[model samples]
Target: MNKLISELRRTALVAGDRVALSGEHEQFTYTGLIVAVDNLAEELSQRGVRRAALIADNSPAWIAVDLACLQAGVALIPIPAFFSAEQLEHTLTSCGADTLISDRRASDAQIASVLAGSTATSAFESQPQFRLWSLAVADQAASLPLGTVKLTYTSGSTGAPKGVCLSADKLFATAAALNTALLATPLQRHLAVLPLATLLENVAGVYAGLLRGAEVILPRVQSLGWAGSSGMEISDLTSCIDHWQPDSAVLLPQILKGLIAIAEQGHWQPPTSLQYLAVGGARVAPEQISQARDLGLPVYEGYGLSECGSVVSLNTPAAERAGSAGKILSHCDVDISDGQVMVKGNVYLGYLGGAELDSNDILATGDIGELDDEGFLWLKGRSKNLLVSSYGRNISPEWPESELLAYAGVGQCLVIGDAEAYCSALIFVTPGYSYEDIGRYIRECNQRLPDYAQIRRWAALPKRLTVADGMLTANGRIKRDVILHTYPELVAHCYPGIVYPIGGSQRAFTPTQTMNSQTDIDT
Candidate 1:
């Protein structure tokens, strides 16, 4: 048996009545959770389910299904409900899953269409919250790498998301490391903020919380006001946090920004029950981190990728350094190779349908980072995103972008300057803010950056960069190539001799000119 299951059983035997999982309207004690997992595992094994796909909202049943799959030795694939129809089809078909278990009713046309040809069954009749269907797919056990138990897909910068193959041991190893790091604080109750399908939330949030014997809150995605990867109702989320008063939670940088905005506007205050609020999914601005701490939010920054089984390093209350990704977790050893971060231990098996990787092979993270003298991992940006100026100076766009994001007025932004004399930016202003607000923020950001990396020109986009529009990943990271391809005219306007519509007039810039005044730059 896997370590996760073994630990769950041990906890159940010791504290059977203790609440292990809590949903919006239901709760499960440790004993109840184990019984549910055992029953579902037996059903899956009886039905000969080689590989299973799960699609459901955040709920106790979701985790029960995941645990059941692990115990039954069935490969499980979690399909994000927010994925586009094309992506959904690709994942369901490509993973070679023979069974699909989901709570979504047949009324959802999009999901129903995807399940058109599958055969319906009563395999999970005892579990009223979900339906089990058998898919007529070819057996693909030979194709998968040995010991592969979970297949997770990341909504990358491209349309086709690849499935990351991970073993049960590696997944639990990451959870163990995270649990060890947090032993100092000892979380009692953890609220699920991100979608449970997210690998980070699955391993770090659910697995680690369970190992620590803490109550895991699993509210529906709609209740949290999450819409896809880019949209969220911050007010609803903060209200939920206030209602639950959870001791631990995880968040993306965008969510943290929203919380900071609401707190700054005096509309809401962070609950004191929150002990450790970990922020990940993307690089967060140092200024934002400082602002959150000032407002009494216990925010910590961490870094990870699906390739590394979710969390590679994190910051705990016992040991932390703001702006860094935190000391590397005990499960992995990190090395800087050619300015890129490479991880050796506790790495993934390989991508689905790809050659199996040896256990000792180093995984290049594609991110540029370094270890500090105190063992903190500091991230710069994506190695491929480095911009070279006409003056032969190399700069990372994330440096200036992070500064602009420090101001709440700038909702989303991207720095652009390749072979150009100076840097330029594409900014999306917040709803209540104006171009002037973003212009001033850019000026402030420029002051902090060197001349070569400063934003000398900028254009305000008409609409927000959203996941639906293919401008951002579901986790709120900007898709640089997609944005560049989508708005060629606006990009050209930032260069020279091109006027693009902004507000009520044309905004253009000249070569070798600096935006010293708010009016001088068109945001």
Candidate 2:
């Protein structure tokens, strides 16, 4: 057995009566958790389910199913609830998943629709808060690496999402390192704010909490203030924190921004019990970090990717730098090669249906970064995301975008303009901001940026970019290609010859006229 499952059994034996998991309608002690996992694993083993797909909201049953898969030695594939129907079908079919466990009736219908042609059998149960389905054929010969235990699909930049194969040891090691790095105590209570489908939350939040024998709050996403990929209710989230008073939580940059806004409004404050909050998923503005600290929120920034099994490095209370992702964890080795961050140790097996990544070969993280003398890693931006101007100057959009996000008015900004005279942006302002307010904030940001990277012109988005709009990934990273394709006319309006009216109208201009006007603006 792997170390994680063994530790979980030991924890259950040692702390049998202690609360191990909690949800909206149920709670489980360590003994209860162990019993639940064993029961489910027995059922799955009896059914000969070698691979199973899990699609459900955060709940005690979700954790139980995940643990049961580990116990049963079945390769588990967690399908994100936010995935499109087509994407979901592709994952299930490509992975040759033999069974599916999901909580929602709507999800059951969706799954049935996807498997309509197959001779699949279905069963409903109330105790586990999910229905079970057995497919007609299982692709017993699915191509996967040996010892593959988990298949996490990435929110792809284009086409269907790819599955990232990971071993149990790699994931457990990450969790154990995180638990040690954060100084997690057995008494600690962790709130699951992000979905379990997110590897970061799965490894660092759920796994770490289990490793420490900590009580994990596993409420559904809606109960935690998440509406969709990009929408959140700050008031609802603050209420959850105040009520739960969890010792630790993991968050994305946008979620932290929302909480900071509530704190700044004096409507809420970090609960005294809240000790460690790790923020990642995107580049956070240093100023925002300072603001969070000023608000008495222990917000620490970190960095990682799915290929690295979620967390590569993190900011712990014991060792932290303001703008860095913190020192690389003991589980991984990080180095910068020609401006790209390379990772070794605890790396993933590889993408499913693709080349098997050799562990000996250093995993070239597409992100650019630098390691400080203190061993802290600071990320610059994605290497491929660099924007080159007609003047041959290369600029990272994240640099200027981070500066823009520092302002309260700017909710999100996408900097673009490759081969153009000057840089331009598509700005998405927070509610209650006027055109003038956004423009003033942009000007302020422009002052801080280099001339080549300054936003000479920009247009406010009609609405926020969201997963529904195909503009953001499930974890909140911007889908640059989707945005560019979805709004070509709006992006073009940022150029000099094209005019964006105050009422949000687009007008095109002649190429020669546009070039001359842009040259003048550049000068």
Candidate 3:
């Protein structure tokens, strides 16, 4: 009884021949798309797959299998390709997934390790692009809430991520709201930029686009220039955008920054066809939004979490505020209680193995924000991330991080000052930017901040924080605890007295000091 599938059926009857999905090697019309879903759903039902996990890159076939699971009334778990082998094993085992659907081979070393305890059979003949494995592991004692359809895991900073159980009704409600939000500039060709495993892209990008009957572009992640979690080739991304000419896309803040760099270089121009480019997954600097607008990129900032069905508020062409997260979506009722953002009306069923919520239950989002007089929701930072300086002054790391990100040279940075004399930063610069460039940027950034919040000492990281190293989540949010645990030396080096051994040509500095003053530290 999924309304989205029913709507897809209705759309197919009228526009059966219209293109619904386009991938690198294949295309599916609306009619063809339905047929594929039906065939796979029938197979899944016959196989008695109560719960299944999907692991694959973005493609038309991936979408087909996803819809198939929905049609078959199977609870689906989507594990991102960027997840470590440990995470993959944890998800499959924790969710009691009876079957696994992936594009990876059964003989793959990582796959083999996770599937070791279970008896599995691959159905590679039926699905050419994907392998279907029936697992015979003991049914887990944990149970999903009644009516749960999709168990989407948040890319948590820890080794074991939690799965947010959601129903079809919740997902479609958010998608419907997103579709309505984009009514002013209807999408014709929507590109899938973020991995479909990401709930934000799955619900907002795919479901919303499909609701509007717009063509959803599903290119391979590599072709889109995605290199794992923290790396991307901006040139390849620009070429994809130029070639696809998509009218709509969802981007992470880093991607938007890269696009701005390309535009500033005058090497490329963003496609005029891109009418709506939604940026989220992190706090986007207002300066970045201004630069994007100046470059003709229709960038809108939105805010949401997986527990709220992926999106709660968005900045649309019709309604937008530069520094705000945007007006709350129609499907959501947001209230600020005790300086925390609480959401109701469109929350999830519950987490995996957790108590299900009643209809009246409110979700404490753990984010600090305020709703303006005009209904725009402006976010401050995460309440859990608020740092208390040694001076007893409260500071939000996101405040200084956002300022650093506004500059083109500063790629990624995290401000740390909890119980410290003053703020310190760990920085990763983009190519062609030197330590002096970053130092100058931080000095300028410090001028705008109060004395307590100003970053006094900084150090260059040997490399960017990446998901593989457990320093960043799949969506590129820094794992503060993991970074603190793994880089104790780097953190020590940022302080006034502590000296730590660091390899590579990295250096720790004060804004006013030259590199020659501090000893060279290598990563």
Candidate 4:
């Protein structure tokens, strides 16, 4: 039996009437949650659901289905709602998922179209404010790693997302480590801000909260102000935080930025009840972290990937550095190899439909980082994203981009200038910021960076990169390749006299350089 499931059973036995989960409209005690998991597990087992895929918003039902799969020893795959239809089709087919559970609002016709020509039958079950469906698909030949309990698909530097297979042991171990790091206890109330499909939130928020027997809040995404992957209503988020008064929450850097903006505008102050606010998913500026702290937000930065079961290191109150990802979690062994971050313990089983990896093999994380004397890990940037200037100077775009992001006006910034004289940026400004204002902000950020890494030129993007636009991963990381492909003209405009190669040596354009007829560049 999974240790997490065993822990859940123990919690139910010890705190039968203690609230385990709460939604916007409903609540469940530990005993009630256990009973629901048993009922759903029985139902799924009777239907021969060896592998199940879940596509739904955050809710009590979503938690129940996930726990039920673990209870029944069934492999569970979580499909991010932000996924494109084509991506979704690829994941469902590649994983050979034999069963699917989704919310009712999800278009049946659309799902059927994605699953068309496959031998699958669907049935609906009525639930409060949400409808559940059980789908039986044709048996697949693909085999999973032994003891596989979850498969999470990540959008790599490719069109098709790859599924990372994981086991309950590794997941629960990480959760326990996080619980210990955060000093979480049964009295903690965790509010789910990120989607439950996100591995970080799933393990760090829900799983860790459950391990501590804390109340996990799983409200609908819309209720918390999220519209798809990129849009947010800060007012709604603050209101929800005020109403829930949660002690813990996980957030992306962008969300943390938004909250800081709200607080800076004197519109709201984060409730004092918020004890632990984990911000990650991208490089965050230390200045932003300081600002959040000054605003009474106990924001901590962490780092991880799906291959590491979500969290490898985190900045707990006990062990934290100002500009580092934090100390390595007790459950994993981390080291720097050839300037790249490598992790060994608690590594993923393997990609779905791929060969299983030896548990002892050190996984080479593409991110480059170093460990401080105090054991705090400082992330530089993705090794693949290292920008080499024409003068043979190497720069990590994330370094300067982080400084740029510290400004209140800049919403999203991508630095790109490989083999060029200096760096340039594609920026998306927060609403109400003018080009001149943003230019001033960039200049201010430039003062904090080296000359070679300063933003020499920049163009304002009409829209922010987002999952809906296929320019961001489901976890909110920018898809650099996708953005470069989608906006070649804009990128070219940033370098009027430079002919940047897509995948080869860079060449200089002729003297009669004619910039693309697009938005004006700020220098």
Every model's TM-score: 0.76, 0.75, 0.77, 0.74
lDDT of 1 by residue, 1-523 (tens): 8899999999999999999999987889999999999999999999999898888899998999999999999999988765666667677777888888888776674478778877678748447778888776755433678888999986533345678999999999999999898889979999999888888899999999999899999999888978655457999999899988999998877688778989999999898898899988777677888899889788998988898999988988888887899989999999998889999998888888887897898999888999988778999877688665533234677877888888888888888876465678888878998667877777776655445566877876667889997888999899998777667655776776445333433322322223334424532
Least accurate 10 contiguous residues by lDDT in model 3 = 514-523
Candidate 2, pairs of clashing residues: none
lDDT of 4: 0.78
Q: For each candidate in the order shown, give its overall lDDT on alpha carbons.
A: 0.81, 0.77, 0.81, 0.78
Cα error, candidate 4, residue 276 (Å) = 1.0
Worst 10 residues of 1 by lDDT: 506-515
Residue 293 C-alpha lDDT in model 1: 86
Per-residue C-alpha lDDT of model 2 across residues 302-419, encoded as one tens digit per residue: 8887888889888877888888888898899998999999999888898887778766857998888999987899987776976645333346777778888898888887988764
Using alpha carbons, what is the TM-score of model 1?
0.76
lDDT score of residue 412 within candidate 1 = 86
Tens-digit lDDT track for model 3 on 419-447?
46467888877889987787777888766
| C-alpha RMSD values across all candidates | 11.6, 12.1, 11.5, 11.8
